[model samples]
Target: MKLPRSIRVIERGWLSANNIVLEERSEAVVVDSGYVAHAPQTLALLERALAGKKLARLVNTHCHSDHMGGNAAIQKKFGCAISIPQGEAPAIDNWDEQQLILAVADQRAQAFSYDDTFRDGDVLQMGGLDWQVIAAPGHDTHAVMFHSPEARVLISGDALWENGFGVVFPQLFGRETALAETRATLEAVGRLDVDVVIPGHGPPFGDAGAALERAFHRLEGYEQDIARLARHCAKVMLSFSLLEKRSMPLAELPAYVARVPILAELNSRYLRMTHAAMAEWLVNELERAGAAGRREGLLLARGE
Candidate 1:
């Protein structure tokens, strides 16, 4: 997996978004700060990657907690200017937990301020390479992807993964345009002359066309049955919580699901199961998927 000499990809596990450090001359730019729980690790990686150079800027593709949770810590450490997608600017400025999806999902991310915001079609010069910011509104309505023409590389933030795109999150929020936007976003990516794609959660891959085909296939299934997508979202949220908490008492799991707003919404809209039932189902599903296991009286996250 040889990447351009100027950019370094720090592939964080599923709990944290990958961080891309772009170095040019004496300054550095970091994209996506990862989850707050891993802020210290993110900083250590940056320190090693940036060496003695100054971190000049930090940019986020979306307001997702896994991607932007370390903003405050990084800002405090480097005094770097922060840039975020324009659509999430107001949420960040107001520090409204309810407005941000992180809060809705019951995820934790320390509030932080942004120095500026970039809109779709914006061009950024980082690591002496020109990258264009393009709107990607499926996984996140305000998400953006960065494309470098010379390198034929794209930083696809949760928009297009090697296996499939992220969950159509807007659909869960009662937005009907989500499927259409996702289809359009995929088409837009298809039009780009990309040789490599750096996805938000996976390792960089070179087969953009094949990945698109996979994404389209997944989209077709989701379009046909949104219940499937909602189920996936439920599992993902539970998996993420497990990844963060490691384990929880079996008895407490029900109340836990009931507490998260997004989990409750998923239950009410699609699953329609009681919180206890949802929690039990989630645990069973996780165990079935080998993502979790039961030990004694506790449900333990897998591979922990």
Candidate 2:
């Protein structure tokens, strides 16, 4: 059934993402405009929700392309001032393709002018209520979560969810300590006295406490794998040594011998080590163990 147009959810389904619209008086404030593919639908939603009113402000939790995809479309249409978290001003301002999350496709995005900066403890008044800015890392290192205390609502950007957190690929992209910082942020979020959680991906969860508990429990198990990786860093170190002898791109290596997931996951966790360092660990560990061999610039496995 079609939900009432009030504060309608623009569920762009997949390619576009979702957007949250706030209607105040005749005016509106749209948050996280999804993607360019979803721009038309977002505008249509705004048209009905605004009811002849204009969009006063456009804001984003962080600068992920998907979150800010419709920025230009909205800006051109309503000419509203755009605001984002202070942590990601530069990337958001320039729309730097490399740093706007792990965008698999190499594509530049439409530019949007930045008007304001948000930080932790700051309140963004939307819909006649103050939405507090809460730092939420892990998914995007500079991401921020929005909280509206009066409504007990939280706009959790890829941080806490009904199941678990997003991929900790920020390290591969450049952000260090992404997982650690995210864990700390999630723990803090779990403690908040709230009733609903509107995450970046899942449906709005009414039982915030129970959802938070499940998220934390998932964190615990993930942490154990992280610890095991740290203790077994020598394994990856040895593997890279084999690859070094060949000279292949990282992606060409065999599954069992390649440092695709394991080492990448470790590097993402440490957040402190560079890809070069992480590569060194994998090569050294696997090469010496004879598990991997360097062949024609490619890292391959001796068996399986």
Candidate 3:
């Protein structure tokens, strides 16, 4: 990887977001602590990487549980100052799990406080490099990406990935302009002179141009039929659920889907199928796509 000598990448699997640790002399910055389920692992990685120095600050590209779920554990451990997108400060301050998508999807995140907020065009300095904060609003309305012109590096938080980007939650909630926002975000990323991209999920990739091309092509395909986009979101949520729970009894899948407000809402708006039908369809789709498999009336999330 062409990363700074001071930066270390912690590659996490699907359920937990990747963590980037940038150490500079007396200061250390950790970005996007993984899911709470993996907090212990995250802490271990940070401890080994930091050696004995305390973590100075924590930054979240967005407030998604996978991205910031480890915040409480990390903050408690290091007493680090936290920074997050300015738009989500209200929901964080109020601890609205519902608004945070925690209650709706039954996702978990321990509450943590942020001491500072960043907006689009703001500059953040870490590891002796200045990163420009760029707004990226489709995936999560308040998401942002950090770009280091000096290093030709872009920390793309769900805006652009090696394969595809994150699910556009805003679109499933009837925000028609969300897809357009995603397109705009992609365009903004395309305009950057990037050499390496540190994505929110997968490992860092070198060919930024190729990734942007793939992302734009997928964006165009989704634009043709919004329902197709909705179906993608449903599968993503289902896969995430499967990732969380290694396996679930066949009979419980529908009830499980029905219990998740966000999944049910997506089905109501797009799939429009009953819980049983939707469950079967989602599972079938996953199996067909080779992302999951059914064994003895139980669904297992396939390892990627």
Candidate 4:
């Protein structure tokens, strides 16, 4: 799919969310600055893309580590103002690692201040188009997506991926409305007149209808079995850690899961397995799903 000449999508790997650059007349705006560990690369890429134009602002769909980790670096390098969803402003301002899922999930993001926040119904002019901010609450209760009606494009930040949406973390944490909110979010996406969807972690894709169908089906499965959702979340968290660390010693994998608050909570609440068993299951699941592989004494990230 051909995006507007003013808009550029930099598809990143699973460890980092994709970065979208919106070129304006004199300055540019960036959406979602990949993971903190990849900040240097992100800056390098933006330098080439922006050429000599100044970066006016940096915006985020949500404040997840992978999606907004590079905020501090970007702001320091370009002197760009940062904006985030109004719902996440408090967490960001307070630097609450628990609420941000950084400590809970064993993830990391640099603390950064935002100049402003946007809410649903707000219109942001980017790349010469007015993109409407839409609330998307499931993966992260404060997450949002952007849709440009004139361009028929949607920047879905882990809300509605081509194969499936992001993990509903609230559900695993015992939020009764999480599943329903996910359904509502998907239904809302179904109502949009979108020709292309630029997801947070994948390449831009067309065929929004098919993507919604797949997301709905996946949601239905999660609705049927909450344990299934927990297991999926466990695998995802583990795979993400593997991606960040490259490899982990097989002997320490069990202790690693036990030490991580989210993984420990998931095992106690849903899986109800011993730490060793949980680690074994996670390793096997990742290998089976082609997300990880066991080599010698290490569990290595695969197909990232």
Candidate 2 or 1, higher TM-score: 1
Off by over 4 Å in 1: none
lDDT of 1 by residue, 1-304 (tens): 4568999899987888999998899999999999999999999999999999999999998988899999999999999999999998888888867656776787899999899999888899888899999999888788999999998989999999999987775356656688889999999999998988998988999999999999999999888988888888899988988899898899998898888888888888888998888988998999999999999999898863
lDDT of 3: 0.88
Return the TM-score for candidate 3, rounded to 2 decimals. Answer: 0.96
Q: Sort by lDDT, best first: what order?
A: 4, 1, 3, 2
- 21-72 per-residue lDDT for model 4 (tens digits): 9998989999999999999999999998899999999999999999999999
lDDT of 3 by residue, 18-126 (tens): 8998888877999999888889999999999889877899999999889999999999998999999998899899998876778787688889989999999999987
User: What lDDT does each candidate get?
Assistant: 0.89, 0.65, 0.88, 0.92
Please tell me which predicted candidate would have the highest TM-score against the true structure.
Answer: 4
By TM-score, the better pick of 2 and 4 is: 4
Scored by lDDT, the top model is 4
Question: Which 10 residues in a row give candidate 4 its minimum summed lDDT?
Answer: 167-176
Q: Global lDDT for candidate 1? A: 0.89
Please write out the lDDT profile of model 2 over residues 134-249, one tens digit for every residue.
Answer: 88877677888888767777878677766765555433546558668877888878767677776666566677777777877766665667654353543533332332233445
Candidate 2, superposed: residue stretches over 4 Å from native: 1-7, 102-108, 226-304
